[model samples]
Target: MPIYVQMARCCWIICFLVFSSLFRAYEASPGDSDQLYRACLSQCQKTSCVGARCFSCCNSASDGSPLDASWYNIKHLYFWWNHWDCQSNCRYHCMLYRENERAELGLEPVKYHGKWLSRRQYGFQEPISVAISALNLVMHFHGWRSFSNLIYYSLPLKPDKTPFYDYAGLFNIYGLLAMNAWFWSAAFHFREMDLTEKLEFSSFVALLGYSIILAIIRSFSLRTDAARVMVAAPIVAFATTHILFLCNYKMDYEWNTKVCIGMGIAQVASWSIWCGATEHPCRWKLRMVVVGGIFGVVVKMLDFPPYQGLVNSEVVLNASNIPLTYMWWNFIKDDAEFRTVNLLKKVR
Candidate 1:
């Protein structure tokens, strides 16, 4: 044989040996034992093996018993379509069933056997699992669809006014609301209903409420230019951060954080620029930027336990300790978008 062929054969043998060793190790591992138990439980439930004992069969088999009740129960339940009550059986019966099934069939039962059998046997289960799956899929699709529509409609092709702007404005408003919904959901999930947590959560709700009121006022004030500018700032900032992350560019923490800080600076600068160009341009915008910068610096400086930096990096902060940071990002992005849209209208 050629030297290259000989080397290839050796490599193949080495790969096979490595895989075999790994498989053996996995089978011996404590974690794998827990996984096996979960797998067995899931399979038994799916097969509709009612009142079947599980633990006795596993233990008996481990002790080298001749009877394989677990295997029999699994096979029987797998073949027969039955009720959910099968899942609540005594551990001993299920174990015996498992042992019997294993002795007869020489293999463990499959997961989700009930659903698969139902589809094959009775055409489908009531409240068809497929329908539920489809509903979930459509919900995800709609979320992306809404995002795409917002992007397409919000940006002006030319500098002049057109119907596209109005459609885009509507889409953007809806998109912001949807984003708020996502944040609120996250807040609610984290809330423990404790007095302190409840108070913090309520503050988030208030912020969202105030944002909605501001949006409504802007819509009615005929200040679309200012609103466009405000809204655009956050959207652009966020989009920029997203693009960077997608392109694998390293930014400080996640894209959302960069966007939050960016939007805050941009909004203040836009206001300052506007003021400077107009009569009596005060230093309020500059002051706001300085204050925000100082606050960020202070946050970085004061690193308490659990509120300290993230484990992965020096600068990156732990998410659990920085609820306020997330709030800041959302608020900045929202305020910036609203202001940007309105500003654009002024220029137009």
Candidate 2:
């Protein structure tokens, strides 16, 4: 071959080899550090080989350089960005380096650093936390004072005896009245408030009031059309309103709203049966056997885990905790324990 031709062929072969090697390196998986380093070097060399036609090629190429100091710096930066520690280090490094660079260039870094900073003097507590705390307090009070024992249960009739009012029955009636009073008080308090306040107050009070009343009545009566009306009205009303509110606001506190509604409905059903039976003792045994059993099952169902998901809120509790906490004091009694036990026996 001619001397010039031979030299040109040799150059072409060298170029081909270099291009192929770089291509292979770029295609290598980044899982292995050694492989990644090699790939970076290959990419840098390939870029440099192409010359300055590629603007910003110098920075890109420098990333792969094999020089110990250059490689170490690039590797450190890569790890910093990819690892879990990046979140903490990123802000610090960006600020420090950007600041130093800006100072050197006689330019000011932007005032808004893109980092989250607290502007408000106060931090808000979560609603769920507040709710849990309130629940704990109520549970504690109920436990210590035996407030939960105030339920009513009836006995089957005996041939020579007449039905009589039991302590449980009396407590149940009183408990209903007290719950109703508190509920109405809250409703009035929030009557002039904003949408959020209205929703919170209305939802809570409605649920609680309706449930307690139902429980009171059921402990005394049996199934009847009147009982059904009383039991269903508040539940349907609350559920309808709650759904409307949710549709408008997409609030996360809807759980409590739903729970309240469900409990209200359950209590009404339970109480109506109880009351219905009380109103007609001749048919009471039969009516209680059917309606009473079903009502008991329904109330138990309301206490299940699925129902709990509806009302378990930290945010609601937190927001309403102080008021609820204070309100609970009003429900406390010196004789709460005795009353509660009596009430529980009646209900049972």
Candidate 3:
């Protein structure tokens, strides 16, 4: 076999190992299993009690009847969902506590929207996830400003002189796509609506695939308009096709996961190898970025079943990933500026 083929095979093996190790370590530690229940009970003790139990305020049956008898009556009564902004999570947990107590007395577990309340988040809405998404959107918008300034003022005005200028449009598009993706991410986590979920997933996949294309184009120094378009067109088509397949036809979780993982590996690997091979000043920074990116992926994958705490998966993963990418982007831009300056000096 050719050495290049062997090297390519080795890179794939390493990526597979990285993902497998992350998958294996994706267990959430439910430390002190009764801590949340105790906390809920403590809060309940502070409120005015109807008999021995706290008043049904946030997520309980309104008829003041026993859950065992009126299970159907309040099964769908999610006060937290109705008044998400106003309802406290304490009240939600209190409702869960009540359900647990009732179940011990032979009452069946209650279902809301065809899902058992146990699987539902502590509250009807995921405030943490929403907040993280908002923060990520803000970061992306701020990066947009920085990126705009870098592209417009930092790059040479004469496109005939440098290859980096041809990429301005692609970078700008990437920023817009990132912001759009985060917007839908926040919306989906806020409401978990079907449409929002599809939008978020599609937008993010588009951003990921586009990032890979951008990395390849810039890394190889493909500055000509024709070369840039040739490389980007196929990637854009694939991303758009995948999004349409997901949103219009079937939202296949398994396929989505596979494609996303592939793109993520390609993205990190491309940049890492390019930075290593190039004479860029911030080459070493890419090493840190790739490591952080992998850890971020692990953090994202750890989000799983039994999401029953103040900490949310969406929040954690976004917080972990966004800053790393943000810094990585700045490093990339700096490297481009470095190259652009040298190119201008040579022309002068």
Consecutive 10-residue window with the lowest summed lDDT within model 3: 24-33
Per-residue lDDT over 183-221 for candidate 2, one digit per residue giving the tens place of the 0 to 100 score: 433432222124534455454455455444444443433
Candidate 1 vs candidate 2: the lDDT winner is 2
Instruction: Arrange candidates by TM-score, descending.
Output: 3, 2, 1
Model 3 lDDT, residue 180, Cα? 96
Candidate 3 lDDT, 266-347, residue by residue in tens: 7777666666566767777777888887776666555443345446444566777677767866875776677668767888
Clashing pairs in 3: none
Off by over 4 Å in 3: 1-124, 154-156, 159-166, 301-307, 310-314
- How many pairs in model 1 have backbone atoms within 3 A of each other, for residues 3 or more apart or on separate chains, i.e. clashes? 55
lDDT tens digits by residue: candidate 1, 252-279: 2222222333333433333333333333
Task: Kindly indicate the candidate among 1 and 3 with the higher TM-score.
Answer: 3
Better of 2 and 3 by TM-score: 3
> Best candidate per TM-score, number?
3
Give candidates' CA RMSD values in order: 21.4, 29.6, 9.7
Angstrom error at residue 150, model 3: 3.0
* Candidate 2: segments with Cα more than 4 A from true spot: 1-124, 127-132, 135-145, 148-225, 247-348
Q: lDDT for each of the candidates?
A: 0.36, 0.38, 0.64
Per-model TM-score on C-alpha atoms: 0.23, 0.24, 0.64
